[model samples]
Target: MYGFTIVENLQKIDQDIKRQELKYHQKRVMVSKEFSFDAAHHLHCYEGKCKNLHGHTYKVIFGISGFVDDIGLVIDFGEIKKIWKEQIEIHLDHRYLNDTLPNMNTTAENMVVWIYEKMEESLESDQKDCRVEFVKLYETPTSFAEARREWMTHE
Candidate 1:
């Protein structure tokens, strides 16, 4: 069995490690973040129960890729959260999907693409060489729709 051990000494910058050693490699990497929100929506011209207004605790996952910066960071989790909160989630969380989102059917498939685009748009303005790799929007725990970078770029 593994035993817990307390840290004895914290490495000091410039003494134990140099600033040049902060970045470990020069390779592209991907980071992911997931967030959840609750919203109500009704599908248009649908032939199912979803035609009526219903609510779901939706989940969204983002995959972003880029070359790491000097500090071995591709993008900080907090920065991703900030982008989600400020640019994307504002139009999503707790808002009526049919009204808040751009005119669409409000389906997970559509939403995922919208999310990918929004993140890409934000990254273009804020991050250097960072791009959205994929976005998965979950309408239910077992159901989701995904948008990928290749798919987006080709079309």
Candidate 2:
């Protein structure tokens, strides 16, 4: 009985090691990160509560789909934060969205598209293997808007 248990445990450990090795060699991965910012904006030519100036502690989620390099990562999360903060947050955080993006109507739908564009601009590589996959923005606790690269491409 003791010999049988030892063999079973060895087999399990070997199987687990093989799984980890396979994961390390995985070529493609989906990486995502979430961030939040506070900003105020008012919709133009709209008939609703959003038309009046207001603020929201907005939440944003970014997704990247890419081929993992030798480091076994699509991109570092810290790098993502730095890119977002420099490219987008500096202009939007604690500022009026209307003034920052004058052409945009300051709606969540519009803002998400703008964010996606900024992310694309920040990336150094144009390789198709890695790219911005999606953006999810929450204007309110229950209400949100999202854009996906596949959806945008069709449009």
Candidate 3:
């Protein structure tokens, strides 16, 4: 009876270890970061109020998805923040978005897409563990625009 109990306990321990190993091996996680900038813009074609230069405290949200690597991280938050600051935030902060992206009118929708593209391009070049999943651009606290790739759309 004593021997049988010992065998049963060992089997249970082995199963628990296997379960933990499987959990560690199966990797799916999503991480996100947010940034903000204040920028001015004007629409060239607008005949109304927006034709004049205007500014907004823009807030940006970025979502990244992928398996956490062996180090148990999707990607370093600092790295993402750095990329954002360098690629998007610093350039647009307190400056005219229209002057930077002159080819496209700096509407909220177009800015969102442009941000998404910037994030995608930066992440593709910098981070290998995760991909830029979504981008949201807030023109104001109440108004915002979002853009996602066709592959990333949820149904």
Q: How many residue pairs clash in each candidate?
A: 0, 0, 0
| Candidate topping TM-score | 1
RMSD to true structure for each model, in Å: 1.1, 6.1, 8.8
Worst 10 residues of 1 by lDDT: 146-155
- The local lDDT score (0 to 100) that residue 114 gets in candidate 2 is 92
Per-residue accuracy of model 1 over 99-137 as CA lDDT, tens digit each: 999999999999999999999999999999889999999
Candidate 3 residue 64 C-alpha distance from true site, Å: 0.8
- Over 1-155, each residue of candidate 2 has an lDDT whose tens digit, in order, gives 35543455554544666545534766667899999999999999999998999999999999988887654677788888888888889988999999998497999999999988888778744344667889999998898999898977763
Candidate 3 per-residue lDDT over residues 1-155, each given as its tens digit: 35543455554544666544533644767788999888888987889988998888989999888786654677889988999888877778988777777489889888888788888889888888577777888888999898876644455
The prediction achieving the highest lDDT against the true structure is 1
Off by over 4 Å in 2: 1-23, 124-128
TM-score of each candidate?
Answer: 0.97, 0.80, 0.78
Indicate the residue-level lDDT of 112 in model 1.
92
Query: Which rank order by lDDT, best down to worst?
Result: 1, 2, 3
Predicted structure 2, TM vs. truth: 0.80
